[model samples]
Target: MKNRKHIVICEDAKTRITINRKWCKGCEICVEFCPQKTLLMEGDKAVVRDIASCNRCMLCELRCPDFAIEVSEGTGR
Candidate 1:
């Protein structure tokens, strides 16, 4: 998952989560901390499982030790 990033925009485009695989070490912290269960571990990286289920709480981003996850407003750019 080196130098890889995945972005997902919710239905309303009000929330966007950016996962920076370069910074992520596959610790699974984000997956465990997400209140919405919006993330899942896929091998050595975290992938968005259900974008609509995400509540934009930013829990995953906040819990990521490597600062690899970010939740932003608007659509993914």
Candidate 2:
């Protein structure tokens, strides 16, 4: 199967969260590390649960061992 990617733009449009379903191994590291509970597990993939609550902390991206999650700044402004 092709690698599926999920992207979420924060409410302020200042932060972007990307989740690579193919690279993810269903490990809850990102979900558990998210301080704002911004990430959740959907079946076996990590998904953005609350973009409004995201504070651009990047904990989920940093804690992901598989490098499946990425938190980026800017909205191409």
Candidate 3:
């Protein structure tokens, strides 16, 4: 009899984030709030520079006072 190891892994799939420049104030709130440092300041706006490492924390989108950032769930971006 062979013993099988049970592995329970939470699917930490990377998701894509979209930024709406119109709503962005270039305050870099999301860039600062992201746990993964997924957002970066480009010129006067924030951009999703590290989409692969995004943990879907939603911190960026939620913390944005101007509602500039949007994120997609469950799919690999």
Local accuracy by lDDT, each model: 0.76, 0.76, 0.70
Instruction: Encode model 1's per-residue lDDT on 3-69: one tens digit a residue.
Output: 2335333333566777776777998988888888888998998988887788888888777888888
Best of the two (1, 3) by TM-score: 1
Which runs in model 1 stand beyond 4 Å of their true positions?
Answer: 1-12
TM-score of 1: 0.78
Q: Can you give the lDDT of residue 62 in candidate 3?
A: 81
lDDT of 2 by residue, 1-77 (tens): 44233533333367677776678898898888888998889899888887768888877877789987888774744
Q: What lDDT does candidate 1 reach at residue 3?
A: 29
RMSD of each: 3.7, 3.2, 14.0
TM of each candidate vs. truth: 0.78, 0.79, 0.74
Off by over 4 Å in 3: 1-13, 74-77
Which residue pairs show collisions in model 1? none
Better by lDDT, candidate 3 or 1: 1
What is candidate 3's lDDT per residue for 1-77, written digit by digit as tens?
A: 14322211122255657677666788988888888987789888887676778888888878888876777664541
TM-score of 3: 0.74
TM-score for candidate 2: 0.79
